[model samples]
Structures are given as C-alpha cells and as structure tokens.
Target: MRARLRAPRGLVPSLPAFAWLCAFFLVPAGMVAVFSLGESAYFGTSPVDLSAPSLDRYGEAASETFRIVFVNTLQIAVVGTVLCVLLAVPMAYLITTRLTGFWKYAAIAAVVIPYWMPFLLRTYSWRILLGDHGPLAEGLGVTGGFGIVDTLSGAQLGVVYNYLPLAVLPIAVALDRLDPALRQAGRDLGASSWRVFWQVTLPAARPGIVGAALLVFIPLMGDYVTPAVLGGVQASVVGSLVSSSFLESQDWALGAAAAVLLILLVLAVLAAAALALALGRLVLRAVRPLDLAARLRPRTGTARPARVSGDAWGLLLRGYGVLMVLFLWAPILTILVYSFNDGRTLPVWGGASTRWYAAIPDNAVLMQSIGVSLRVAALSTLVAIVVGTLAGTALARAGRPIRWSLLGLLLVVFVTPEIVTSIGLLLMYVAAGPALSDGTLRLVIAHAVISTAIVAFVVQARLSSLDPRLSDAAADLGATPAGAFRRVILPLAAPAVLAAAVLASTASLDDVVASSMLGNVGTTTLPVYIYSTLRNGMRGDAAAASVLMMLGTALAVVVLAWVMQRRGQGKSFAAGLVGR
Candidate 1:
C-alpha cells in the first residue's frame, strides 16, 4: 500500500468507469434509442416533433427494401465469415503450431502489416487489381474471370479479405491454448488426426470462433465502404441501405430506423451467444462423460516446437497465407508502387512519379482530416485505458451480477454498428444543444464511449485469465486494494491495457462512418480524408494517404509492443488469449 502511494499520484488507478459509461456510452446510446423512436431533424440540432415515440420507424424495418438489404447483409456476412474461417483456421494453425523462429515472426507480421495500409486504399487496390482496368485479367489469361471485382462477389471477397486478420487472430489464440495432449490421446485411442481436430480442437475453439464470427459479421452487416464502391446497387448490403438513407436521400429518420434494427440484430447475436454458452455448460454438466471442453486443454505449454517445413499442404498453407496477405495488401502495395505511377494502371512498370505524394501538402483539407483523426484516436485511447482498466478490475473484484451487467453493456456497445453509434451521438448532441452539438468534443466523446467499451472487454478478458491467488497473495501480505493492484494486477495486466488502448485507437483512427456523420463542417479525420479522396477519384493521392495511416498503425503498434516488452510484459501478451 505504501509502495503504491509512493509510485505516482497520476496513477490514482481508480477512475469510476461506471460513471464514465453512464455519461458517455449509455447516455449517448440511449439518446439514439430515443431518436429511433422519435422523428429526426431537418438541418439543425433538434429532433423533429412531428411524432412522439412511435412504431413508425420500426414499421419501416419491415418494409420490402429492408427485407432485401437485411437478407443481403446476412448472406454476405455468412459467406464472408465462412471464407474467413476456412482461410484463418489453416493460417492460424501455421502461425501457432507449425511456423518456427523468423518464419513465425514473419507470418505474424504478414498477417498484421496489411492493416497499416488505409482500408479505403485496400478496397480501392482490390478494385484496380481485379478490375478489367487492372492486371488480373491479363495476368490470369482469362478475359472475364477477373470481372468478379465489379459484382457482389467482389464485395464479399473484399470483406473477407479485409476482416480475415480479425477472425484469424482470435482463432489462433484459441488454437495456441489447445492441449496437444488431448489430440495425442485421441491418436493413442485410435482416432484419426482429422477426427481428433473435428471432435476435439474445433469444439474447444468454438467460443472464440463464434465470438470472432460475430465480431466480423455484425460490423460487416453495417459495412458501407466495400459495398458502396464495389457492389454498386448490384449486391448492396444493409450498410449501403443505411448510408443511402442519409447521404443520398437525406432521410435521417429512415437511416436511424435501419440503424436501430441493426443494433437489435446485434443484440440478438449476443443473446444467441449467451444461450450457446449456457447450453454448452449444461451439456458439460449433463454427463461427466460428455465433458468435451475439459478434455481439450493443451499439455504443451509451448506452441509449435518446430517451424513448418515443406510439402504440398504446407506449400498450400504458405500459399494461402501469401494469397491472403497479397489479397489484402496488393492494393496498398499497388498504390505504394503506383502512387509513383504516372499512369493510373500498373504492371507495365515505366514512368515512376512521386507527384501524388508531393501533392499531399497541397491537400490542406485532407491533411487537416488526418490531424483530426490522430487527435480523436489519441483521446479515445486515453479514455479507453482509464475506463477499460477500471471496469476490468471492477469486474474481476466485484459481484457476479455487476460483472454480468458490465459485460452485457460492453457487449452491446461492441456489437452496435458505427452508424448506430453516430446516430446515437447525434441525438445526444441534439438533446444537449450547443453544449455538445457543435464541437470536436462530441465526436471525441462518441468515439470514447464505444471504443472504451471495446477496450474494457479486452481488459476484462485479460483480467479473467489471471490467477485470483495473485491478488489474494498481495492482500494477505498487507497490500491495500490500490497497492495490491499497482504491484500485482497492473504490471501483469499492463500489456492487455496497452493492447486495448491500441485497438481503441485503431477503431477511432479507422472510423469514417461515425466521424463523418458526427463531425462538423470541415471536421476531417484520416479516414474521412481518404474517403474524400476516393470519392474525388484521386486514387493516387488517396493511396498515399492510406499508406500513411497504415504506416502510422504499424509504427504505433510496433512501438507499443516494444514499450510493453521493456516493462517485462512479453509473456503476458498471451494473457488475454483465452476468453475465460
């Protein structure tokens, strides 16, 4: 206790995250819920009083247009998710159990580096690469085999391409924690290797797989970017439906209604998750003989004792890894190499130019947007760490009821779409009037609330993995709550906190739909800037800007990883892998 007191007062380490949630996350989301019930405004900061809380908006949810987009969103999300699972399982397997040393590091890096490229740029890159305007047609020796980029299929491919990493990471973590001995026992019991994987490893990793699936699918359901540019109207998803309601038709109420439906759908997904978890527990208890989860714990503390060597499947795995990496990064790479492109098309490799990169300075509006994004991400990261750490610690130490509520609230925020978040923030701002309606503060607050919940989820996941005895040991040694936390919990949980902060920052940085809707005139962020550039057909400069954001993410993450390591947090990086 005395040591903690002496450490630093700045690290009070006891911010009331619940209060933070009420003020930011809950209030804003509640405000949006109200708006979803009421009518939307015309141009100013007021909800239209044309109607007072009605089912009219929700009625719109049942419309045929709604049905089509909803079905489309589901179809795309399901297909994309399936592809992501197939691609990621092998990729994760290779990274965790097969690859060794530099190859391991390289594989991990490869999986992650594509994110440094601006998402818009990556989307655009796929456009050019797969388009008849690009090289895929010529290179693949197929006249129209490459035309897939212009259809709904292209959008699905892009969504899967972009979100593959998100899906892979969680699955890999689950795979990392699997007991190799369980599989060995299966082999000894005369089970085939494939049977062992299906009956043993797959079931063990289901929660993570389910979580990852939901994580990918929900946002992708509300995803605006890929479908907007790639699919046009041919394969438009619900995201496009929601977006067009606002920008194209200027129908905020309709958009808010759609956003509300999306939010409900997300909640339903969480409920389904809970039901599954409960059923699994019940199934576990039903028969001690049916305790499948119990049997899958890994005996090997270490993953992949050796690096993967050669064979067709190994090559196939490596090729898939490369293909996925290329699929994601080739756009950024094309842009990087082609931002120097004197011509819009590539592969001929002739006149190189940095004209676009040089022109970035001239794009004052775009540059300002970048500044806005950085500031938003930085503020969100700060708020997220404080709230996430506190909430996480509280969940670990608090009552079960409180823990479940906190988790439920966090899940609600996590599953909610950005458009819904934006609408919610707008309603809050409208209700609050000029106090919050017309400043960068509102955008920051909106981002912080949602991002913080995500960070808290990460923090809670990490904290739950801790041995409770560690905190108990500190307390038994006469450490006060704060002191014990500082000495024991904080150091151990620091890496998770840092990771949460980074992810929050990335969410903030990458967010365009929310920032654009909530931001004021001339309020710009990197994503908004990239979006504007893409909208303007400034593909080259857009690529340059995208590369910058991607580079920034890479630099920030690398530096964060390095700093965390310096604090002896290297091993604890694995702390939050298991959702327990």
Candidate 2:
C-alpha cells in the first residue's frame, strides 16, 4: 500500500499566522513598494499609476525638505530614547532592588496604567497642559505661558512621556531577572557599590536596555500624533509628511516612497546599533582579563569614606521613584480633573462640574465612536488570540529553520513603523476597490495584523519556559496529539494566553494610526474621533470620554493582575504585558 503523506511537524499549527501575515502584511507592503516606483495620477480614480514606473518618487523623497524632516525625526527619536533610558534605568533598578511586596507591584501598576491608556489621549493631554492658559503655564507664572505649545519643545516632552513606560518595563524585567549573587560577589571582592553596578548589574541588563531602546525608537520614528498635536507646522517630521502625502496631498507615490525611506532609516539605525554592540563586545573581551585581575587584587590602602551611606542612597532612589511615578501619572490626572470642567474648551478651567460626564450619554456621535472601538477591539483580539496561540505553540516545538524564519517575520511585523503599516493597508484596500468596502472589517483586519505579532511573542515566551515532557507524558497515556495539547498544554499556557488577550484588546482599543487611515465616517474608532476633535479644538466631552477610556483600561489591567496573582504568576505579569 502507498504510504499516506504526512505534514511537517510544526507546519500545520503555524499556518494560520503565516497565512494571515502573508496576505495582510506581505501583500500590502509589496503593493506599497510597487506604488513607490509608480507616479501619482492627479486626476485619475486611483492615486497611483504604474503604467510607466521609475525611481522619480524616491529622488523626490530625498529632496532638501524631506532631508530636513528626516533629520528632525531622527533627532527627536534619538533624544527621546536616551531620556527614556536615563529615567528608566535608575527607576527600574530601584524598583527591583529596593521595593518589596505591595509597594513593588503598586509602582509597576503606576507605569502600566499610563501605558494602558489610549496613546492619542495621552498626547492630547499634553496639548491641554501646555496650552497658553493651562495649569503648567499658570503655575510657572509665565503671563501667556511658556511658549511650549505648537513648538519643538512641546513635541519632545510629549515623545519622552508617551514612550517612557515602554522603556521602563523591559528594563525592569531584565533587572529583576538578574542574579543578586553576582552583585554580592563583586562587593565581596573589594569592589565598591558603584563599581559593582557598573561592572556586574549594568552589563547583565544589556538585553533589557537594548529592548527598551528598540521599543522607544521604532514607534517614535513613526509617531505623528505627538508632532501634530504638539509641534504643529514648525516641527513637521517624516511621519507627518508621509501621512499628509496620502491624506491631504493625494500623492500616494510620494507617500509610499517616503514610507520606504522611513523603513530604511530605521533599519540603518538598527544595523548601526548592532555593529556598535559587536564592537563593544570585542573590546570587552579584550579587556576582560585585566578587569578580572583588578577585581581579584587585594586592596593595599585604607578604604575611603563612603560617598553616601546606604540609607541616604535608598532615600534618594525612593525620592526619584516618586518623581517618576508623578511624571507618568501627571497627564492622566490632568485629563481626569479637566474632564469635570464646566468650560466649553478644555484648556481653561471654568470651575468643577460633572456636566461633561452627564453629557456623554447625549453625545450621539461620541457614543457611536465608542461602540465602534469596542466592537473592533473585541473582534480583532479574538482573531489575534487564536492565530497567535497556534503560531506560538508551534514555534515552541518547531524545527530551527521554521522557528527562526517565523520569528524574523514576526520581528519585522513588530518593528515596522505603524504609519507604514497603515499606508500599506490603505493602499491595499484602495487597490481592492469596492470589494473590501466595509470600513469596520478593514479596521478589524488592520488591528489584528498589528496585535497578532505581540500575542504570538508573549505566548511563545510563556510556552518556551515549560518542560517538553508534559505533552510527551500525556501522549504516553494514550492521548491523541490534539487531546494532549488541549488537556495539558492549553491549561498550562492559560495565564499567558489571558495576558496576551488583554494586551491585544488594549492595543486595538488604543490604536490611532491604522484606525484613522482605515476608518470612514460610520466606522470611526474612539481614538480617531478624539484625534479629530483635538485637531479642531479640545472639548470638555472629549476629556470626559478620555477619562472613561482610562478607567476602563485600568479595570482591565487590575483584573488581569489579580488573575495572574491567583495563578502565582504575579511577578511575570508585567513582562508578559510587554511580551518580554
């Protein structure tokens, strides 16, 4: 008898994610690349015409104006990333080493709270705070306020605040994972506290630092919200340029070319970072022996006075931690307080009242947008969880080639600027014509594509830590592969799966880039609605809506934390939230 054909071990399970990404991500991105080579059709039904393709758009993308915008974008990203690292390192170090029990989790929750809130809302809060008559201005005693609003300084501050949590969480996880014995060993060998931290602790946390940098820089490069809301015309970056090229100018070819350049810039930065890291490693290896000898040598002289006592140092760290917490929550609290404003506009306070909260029910358009956001988030999250779980589980058990290949693809998906993804999906939908006309469906697909990589990473990290024998044991008991997976693997991975679900949902709900590009009048997500409102001028009702969204997100975060704690996985929850 002929032997029945058999599928590869991990291929079947990984197919769902692979197929979805190829169709939604790869195909759309390819379309964008094709559009970049074509010319814009000014009066044609389509924005681009590929009848005679050339490299003209790319040359235009490299012109003087674009060069200035690109330089500004890089400067903001580099500076913001450095600030995030500077702030996050000490805070994360203190949290891991000093805080305990309730305070530790509370501190972490503080960071996660702002991160969980909608991105557009967070940026818009800064807009309110920096307004001429806003609280910061009033408190600083600047008559018409410090001229931060609609300027580069305002944009830079927003960038640092918005991406700070992304930098903190990963570093915190890395510092938390460090072995305390390594630091103790250094101290016992005549090394000072500072030396121990520099030689032992910091080097060990390199992965986290690198992770945080990538997390901050990649998205910051694509962030138009902060620049648009805070910087306005003077600080237009490459991201805003790409956005306007399509949305306002109707120049799809130029937009696509600019997006391609943006991606190249990101990749070049990453490549340079990798090279620097490699060179640093080589230098470290060369000097490692001398460093070891110095550490091993006995001290001949009397020790100098301690620079600061342990108590003083601890107090300083605690004080810094308090400041960090305040910085994270300031914008959110501002929104909550101003949501009760009796005034028509958000910037000026006109006494405390609940009219905006009361008016929420009467605001039909806002309510409809809220409903759309909820529906799209729910549906996209469901799809992401299913596809990501299957893909992640298979990845944990797959062969080396398949695992690496898929991981690389997922990393690209994760690191690709959101604006690029939005443009690609928009272009794809436009190419598909009327067949994909449902706005909500487009939003769901776009959101799912973004969230799936995150879910898959989280799930894979969770599953990789489990023993391989669990499923094997189940199989030995005469269970089928499917039965073994359901009975043993699924239950074991539940916490991670649940955590991934929460992340995926929150990401979808908080999304602005894809929602704005893919949504229409009837399908406007709450973030897109708030963005438009803020662009026109912030209203009290929008502030109220932001508060409600923040509370909803906080509730979800609390529930997830409680459930994970019940499972004795509390320590890993934050890392899981960030897919570390």
Best by lDDT: 2
> What's the TM-score of every candidate structure?
0.85, 0.96
TM-score of 2: 0.96
In model 2, state the lDDT of residue 20. 94
Model 2: worst 10 consecutive residues (lDDT sum): 289-298
lDDT (tens digit, per residue) of candidate 2 on 480-564: 7789878988887887888899889988999988998888779998888888887678777867887888797788778878878
* Candidate 1 TM-score, true structure as reference: 0.85
- In model 1, pairs of residues that clash are 100-307, 116-550, 178-298, 179-297, 179-298, 338-341, 369-524
- Writing each residue's lDDT as its tens digit, candidate 1 over 1-580 gives 5553253221233246667767766777766556567676666645454456787877886687579787777788778887887778878877776688778767776776675456676777776677654666667776654667557887888888788877877887787788888777875665445556777777777766876787687778778787766776777766666666766776667777787787777677667868988998798667645554444433455462342334754677777777777766667777677667776533233478877778788888778877888887788778777877888886666666666767676776777777777776776676677688654787688788877766676777787777988988998999987798889988878778877776678778877787777788767777776676554455566566666677767887777767767877744553432222
Cα error, candidate 2, residue 569 (Å): 5.0
Q: Compute the lDDT of residue 436 as modeled in candidate 2.
A: 80
